[model samples]
Target: MVRRWQPPWRRWSVRNRLMAMTAIPLAYLFFTFLWYAYHSRLSEVREELAERGPLVAKVLADSSEFSVIARRHDDLKPTINGLLRTDPSIHRIDVLDAQRRELVAAAARAPGGTAELRYYEAPILKRLMWVAMLGPDGKPYQKDRPAASGVTVETIGYVRVTMSPSALLLKQTRRFYVELLVGSLGLLACVLLAWQLAKGLDASLQASMQALREADAEKRRLIGKVNTAVEDERKSIALEIHDELNATLIAVRLEGQRIADLSPEGEVRDKAQSIIKLALGLYNSGRSLVRRLRPEVLDMLGLEGAVEELVRHYDSARSGCRFDLQARGDFSRLEGDIAISAYRIVQEALSNIVKHARATQASLSLALEQGELRIRIADNGRGFDAALASAGIGLVGMRERVYALNGSIALETSPEAGTLISIAMPIR
Candidate 1:
């Protein structure tokens, strides 16, 4: 047999499951969105760095071109200050010749020493080459940019520019706060949506479970009604057969006896006796059938008496098997479905023992204690597996009958250890 599947999450109630479904998606999306934002910031910084290289190179080339060509030491400081006054971003500047000799330099010594420096170099272009390849902003020359021509010049030296990016780093820090604010807002939105969805899902599941529970209760009620109706019909049939049919059979038997007594002592007399014997056998069979249908002894003797009679009947009928019946409390008032269901349960169990158990001894108990009816039927026979008993139609009928009375049944069985069937019924 294939075992049933039990998922780990099934341990959680519907509410928790809904919460998880709601929260997990929002959490995933929040992290993923923040991750994308972080990478975007990195990419922006990289692009800014790329653009900075060209800007620094252009600044050096423009500021130092005339100074390097004329070899004027006095003009270098003014040129460097002019560059510094235009942009607060620059923290250091250096001008170098083609021979790598420093022509002029400026440094800002902060309390924390020099910030990390980035390097840039540009060659002083001849006047024609400058107009062709260099743009005014010191970017690569483009057709749309302004470049002056007709100036005579040549490559005098290379100008190097060094700059610190502390200001840019601080700007990025401010941007991080803005990014955090945006992320917080997005997370709040996601949480609100997720909570609403989770509540809706939980409500839906609760409604479904409620509907299913009502349906199940209704089904059990219907089954109990059907079982009671069938039982009533059986009782009627048994009464009809017992009262009318048995009387007719008895009358026929009495007539046969009369014929046997009147006839002469010969083959005719023997035939009459044979007819009487057959009629007697049929009467016995009809009595047994009536008992099977609905034992009249039940109504006459009460539950305890009926149970004792049943055990005695079984003990006499079956070979190599003993049936024991024990009881306590006043069972005379035991009536309605309770009585019928209990009697049928015992009847079916005994029939199974005779047909299948091959046991040497069996016992049945009917006790009323503390306003509850307890029934236990045990047999010392070659035991069977629980699967076999569960699959038995007889056991199934017994269970249904017991459940119709809102009772419970339990079975304890293993190979050669005998089977114990226990039942408890609420009498009040």
Candidate 2:
């Protein structure tokens, strides 16, 4: 026979399976949460960089406009360096003239090679204004004319700021680690709870199985008691018939014979002869009934002789089936219940063969070995479908008897293959 393969989880215990089932989903959820949190935090970091980079560039442009117009580049270095020192995220700052020449530059030390940089720019503007309305006498010239004034804005320089996100990324990474730790702890707790639940279920199942076994044992014990009681009743009935009915029939036969001998060749003698014949038939029937109820040969010759006598009787009946018995080992000291159960099992098997098998040959084998009695009954009959056929009373009785004695029985049969019954019973 080839064994089929099963999945690895199929072989796991209930507790393990339950824990795995619980943990897998929790782990998935944890990973999903981490993924969402990482992306969300990254977006926040980007937004902060966008807002802070532009504002710092604009402020530097406004502050450096006057210095750039006066061509005092050296004075602007201190402010640019101070801005870089205050914010570690600002990687570099540059001030350029109208021709895009770097007039002053300040840079902070780069934290890592992989740091991402963002750039923001703002233009430095100079406002020029023209003044009119100056009369020759410096006095107000009241004329019905609107005053004309003009102002012009000109780009003088530009401020460019470079920013890095290494600090924000580090902070996000630390937060993720903390969340992962908490999620792992929660998943482990769920797995432990699942294990505990599985343990409880397994314990309950074991208790139920134990109860069932005890019930089955009690049932077998009750069956053995019933069988013993029935056998005792049968023996009592058989004794009554043997001692009372058969004796009465024998006496009636003797009286009829004497009456026939005294009355010579008359109607009375013919009637007496008929009476004697009827009495003899009744006596023979009673004796046959006694043998069936309780075979006396079992007490005299033990189980082997009783079974042999049974087989011989069946064989002599000429029921179109040949019966054979093969015996081994001594059965003299066999236990009463075991012997009787074994004999009854064989008897039932043979009866079934004769009444239903339509077999040409049947064999019974008995062996006593290692303090156990083994019996096998086989017949070359047109066997029925054992799976489909409802078990007959004879088979049920045989099975109950064997089970009551803590023995085992197996029946093998199929269409056109014949039937075989194997049984084993302890001697003690």
Candidate 3:
């Protein structure tokens, strides 16, 4: 079972969704605040207008020749004109008579009212904001922006001052817009900063995960190389012991047998037979050691045959122990690496059973279900602590090997219960 590595991008992502999530509310709230502030400033401007309106009216009325009708009317125009010039913000200085006839419309010097002017007037006083109608006072009137108190009495006429915003209002509006622009920019900057921060954090985590994966791969490569080298060394030593040493022992045994055949049935003959028996035992032990160093059956006969031969050897070597071995499902049909990995796990488990488990019987079973291959080795021995075994390096090595092949191993054992080792590897 070979597990392919997952790419970093596929594993997790933080950037895409966060930008939209953080940006929306910030923009909405900022615009809402600006809109409220804009209206508030306009209302304040109207209040300022209301405060200045009556003063202009009072000044004009006081200077007029009230006794003469034509002169008073004539006299009023100059006063209105002077006021208009004093504050260039004054758009139109219309002195309307009580009958609402236009006694004076200063802006008559320019073209008359357009539709835009009517729209401007529409929201003026009726919305409780008549004072705001003054166009910009241009410059001078800022110190004394007219506020309509509705304060004129004798009421021969009413003055309507439309301001082109006073310099102060103009400056304030500019400042407000500047502040609004700055605030919006600040908010956008904050969102970008947050996104960058999140992206950095995600990248750091991804880098750490990549480092871990690389380290794991490197460790596996080193372990595999080292294990292969050890096996090669073992094979070399086994060949030396078998081909050179074992042949000498066999020659000595044959010499003893020849001597026994020649001698009579006496003490010398019995000693020769004993020497032959001891030499044969030594040869068998040497053969077993050679097999342990590198099982030739594993390379030549495939995994299942090697396992069956190993079980038979174990059964012969340890006569008291009963072995129950079975190959279930398509055990013969597996990749060499997977089969070898499974074989090693079984070998290690059986070795552990023989060494640690003082058991009467042991069983080994393997099966393939779906795409996964499962191997189980159980013993009815006096079990040790599974926790300790799991924590130990030997068991950890076994598990690491399994993991390297993209498989899993589980050992179930306690002081009371017998040991059970199960491994599963995906073959497809």
Candidate 4:
């Protein structure tokens, strides 16, 4: 099977993902606000410059009319200098006569080559009034009858003001920078808050996981105790059957034999012989049951010997199938629980092979290395689907026994293929 690729963010922990979700949108909004603010501030500064420039020129032009008419341009310099001193936006002021001749000019210090300059012009107007008066002949001269009062307005000179927008822009830039800094700080604060939240959630998740692990461990320990208790009870029953029941069977057989020998050749003698044979068969059956409940070879010869004996029994019983056993390392130092569980696991596997595998050949391998016991059982058989068979009593019992000892087991099998069962148990 091929695994599909996942985005890098998918691998992030819940905490990190949450932080990213919160921060990304906030960052975008913050930058968008800054962009709008920058443009809006720039437009406001430009508008202010436009309004201030034209107004300043009109005022200067009105003031300079008399100075330009009298040709006493020097008189206007003081007013021009005063206006320049009062307002920083005004870069230069010029007074020009009607003929476009420079009369007097006053310019503020150059702001720098990079300063943006704008020009505004306002025409200085002169008003003249013509009144009809008696001529030297003592009569009003009537060129065309004297019109109603004659007043005429004429442009005398111009006032041109040069305005620099650098000051306004600089002020706006400072404000913009401050706003940006504040926004950046706010974003940083949000990220920090997210990090703290994530940390808390992660801690809680870890605590939950730890509790679950402790509970599982406790469950396994309980299972181990139960298995041990069951085994102990089985041993007790086996001992009772071996010492008490077998002894009674032996006594019955001996009495039957005695009756047969003493009785003369008749139906009674034949009945006694039949009784003796029946007793012997019952005794043998009882022995086999005792062995099944608790194998004596396990205690006498340890795990390896017990397993070997079991294999031999199965091999002899099923002539059509062959059984093999391979062992490594010492089995004598194994703990009782580990030894018993391992033996049961192997027993269950072999039983499954015989009952369901329809196997012609099977092999069991055991190894003890680095404080761990490893066992493998394989068979050349018509295997069944492991998933379907997992719920079977035999496999479930094997799995529970292995889990009770905190061991691991893996099963590999498919239809028409051999089944392989592998287990690893920590002996220490």
* Candidate No. with top lDDT: 4
Once fitted onto the true fold, the runs of candidate 2 whose alpha carbons sit more than 4 angstroms away are: 1-198
Give the TM-score of each candidate. Answer: 0.53, 0.56, 0.47, 0.55
Of 2 and 4, the candidate ahead on TM-score is 2
TM-score of candidate 3 to 2 decimals:
0.47
For candidate 4, the 10 contiguous residues with the lowest summed lDDT are: 107-116
lDDT of all the models against the reference?
0.79, 0.87, 0.71, 0.88
lDDT of 2 by residue, 392-417 (tens): 78888888898898888888999999
Deviation of model 4 at 288, angstroms: 0.4
Estimate, for each residue in 1-428, the C-alpha lDDT of model 3 and write its tens digit. 47689865564355554555567787788888898878878777666556555455445444442522353467666766777767544556665655667665675344333422211211011112234334356443344665443432344445555554454367569878987988888897988897887787777767887999999888877765665566678879988998998999999899999999999999999999999999999999999898888777877777888899888877777656777798867566687667766777778777777777878899999788768888888999998886688666667777877776667788898996898888888886
Q: Which is the leading candidate under TM-score?
A: 2
Output candidate 3 Cα RMSD. Answer: 18.4
Query: What TM value does model 4 have?
Result: 0.55
Best of the two (1, 4) by TM-score = 4
Candidate 1 global CA lDDT score: 0.79
By lDDT: ranked, best first? 4, 2, 1, 3
